[model samples]
Target: MILRMAWRNIWRNKLRSITIMMAVALGLTAGVFASAMINGMMQSRFHEFIENQISHLQLHHPDFVGQQEVYQHTGVPRDQLDRVLENPMVRAATVRTKVHSMIASATYTGGVELMGVLPENEKQTTGFHNNVVEGNYLEKHGTNEILLGSALAEKMRVQVGSRVVLTFQDVDHNMVSAAFLVTGLYETGYTRYDESFALVHMDYLNNQINIGNSFHEMALLLTDIDHIPAMTKELEVMFPGLHVRAWNEVSPEMSVLVEAGDVFAYIFLVIILLGLAFGLLNTMLMAVYERTREIGMMMAIGMNKQRIFALILFETLALSLVGGVFGIVGSWAIVSWVSRVGIDLSAFDDVMKEIGFSPVIYPVLETAFFITLILFVMLTALIASIYPSLRAMRLNPAESAKR
Candidate 1:
């Protein structure tokens, strides 16, 4: 009976009721959609770094991790790699000889982190070959072949088949210079990364540095990301001498940024809801003021104050819930359609790439987020109903009945 009365009371002023409902719906839709877009951008950037660049876990010599010394190889035998590969959770693994070196073309020179990797293993682990936008990936038997990032190529004014000079200290700390053919130019849409890294054939680099088949880094991609913590511990136990680190440990800033994005999304939604709460408060207060005479008549007819407060509370909740349902359904439909098609910010392509974000964004929201949103709406309605319900209960029956 109370619910039916509450539902019917809101429609007594149809214009005001519909106006508040539409306001709530529009505010929630905008807030949820904005949150979804931010989520999508953060997820895209994080996965791009993890899957295509960093992998899930890495193994390195203690000195190599600390100082990046070329001679600080993992010192583990090749059989150790075979053992790691035998693990069921390790989906793919590759070893690389990493060095900080200067790469120079005829026109320009720049610093690069040169990674010498087995082409097939590297491809399986990082799928870097898929990013080759121009020319071919390193050939299986290719010697002295190098793949330069597209940004690096542009900065160096080099192209496919261009001869470039690589200069670095060999394992002995002796400066060594060699010529490498640029077999490919790849772009991962992370401009800073593209400008800072290059790849070469492992055997060729090993012979050049006089480090026979030794590698400084071992990167691994796991079958499931949820296994990262367990796998990191397992690898540590297996290779007690080598330093094993998860992707988050390697890049703490990215992890922090992803977490901050989630917090910011909720904060933003709360700010919007607060605004809606004020709107709800104003509307309910006015409704209470206008219906004073009606409420007084009920009170005179023996309706108790507690029931009167509950009626007002129920009316506020009903108004909010009806609006919330419409808003959630509308936001879901918009998010679903937008996620499928994606929102292109091609106009900001260069800036987006420079900052390690994709130009295209696909909005997404978890089911749990919608559930929480409903709870938030209910809470807001309850808080907004408080003052108005108190005012309704405080009215004098004789005076209100006369008015």
Candidate 2:
């Protein structure tokens, strides 16, 4: 009976009821879309950073992570690497030999970390070619040519086909220098990488360091991201002498950004929810004022205060449900369309790249985020009705009748 009365009463002032519903719907739409877009962009950026820049996991000698400079002292053998890669969780693996060196040119000289990679295996495992900004990737099983980061090339005032001398301390602690032709230049948008790293053929390093079949570290690419922690655990148990670390573990900056983004998204969701709750409160408060006499008549006619309160609560709940349903459907349609087309940030490409971010991002609409958002909006509406419902229940029959 109370529900029927409340439903009828809402239609008595259709304009006001609809206005309130629109407010709730708009709030829901904004909250859902904004949260979904932000989360999607963040995930995309993190994934790209991990895939293009950092492989999923890395294996280092037990003491190498701390004493990375002493590559000769802490080298992982080929036999041990073969055993680790036997795990099905490991999708691809590559060996890396790193040495700090000074890259010198006629016009410039700067410190750089020389990364020796197997051209064929590195290309297949790391997609290194896709990141090349100019020229081509290093040839397999070749020497006398090298790839320089774009920033490093610019600093050196050298272009493709130019010659640069790379000087470094060999495994015997003796200075070894070699001059190689610059084959290509690549930009990863990260200042540190672009300014301080060079790629060389792995065999070149072996010859320079006089080491055969040895690597400073092993980088692994995983098929699925969720398997990282599990694979890390398995590697730790199987290879107790090696240290396993994820991409995020190796770089604290990326981890911090991911954590901060999650907190920001939650804060935005809460703020939108609070705004929707206030809108509901306003609507319910106005309903109480307009239906003062009606509520009093119900009290006089044997409807107890509990039923009166239930009536108002039911009205608020129905309004929220109707708005929530519409919001979900409407927001979903918008999100789907936008996700397919994508939001372009090309105008800010240079700025974004300068800050180490990708400009283009496509948001993903997850059903879980939508469902949770709807439930939270509905809960807010229900909670907002408590005070107004209590006010309606406290109305005096005589005073309301006189008014």
Q: Compare the candidates by TM-score and give the number of the best one.
A: 1
**Cα lDDT tens digits for candidate 2, 235-282:** 888767778899888888889988887777778779877887888888
How displaced is residue 26 in candidate 1, in Å? 0.9
lDDT score of residue 57 within candidate 2? 91
Q: For each candidate, what TM-score against the reference?
A: 0.97, 0.93
lDDT of 1 at 218: 88
Model 1 worst lDDT run, 10 consecutive residues? 74-83
Clashes of 1: 0
Candidate 1 structure quality by residue, lDDT tens digits, 1-403:
9999999999999999999999999999999999999999999988888888889999999878879988898877645777888999999998888999998988898799999888888888889999999999989564998999999999899999899999998889999999999989999998998999999998888888877877888899999999998998999999898899899888999999899889988987998899889988999999989999999999999999999999999999998999999999999999999999999999999999999999999998999999999999999999999999999999999899988
**After superposing candidate 2, which stretches have Cα over 4 Å from the reference?**
none
Highest-scoring model, lDDT = 1
Q: Tell me, what's the RMSD of every candidate?
A: 1.2, 2.1
* Candidate 1 clashing pairs, residues 3+ apart or interchain: none
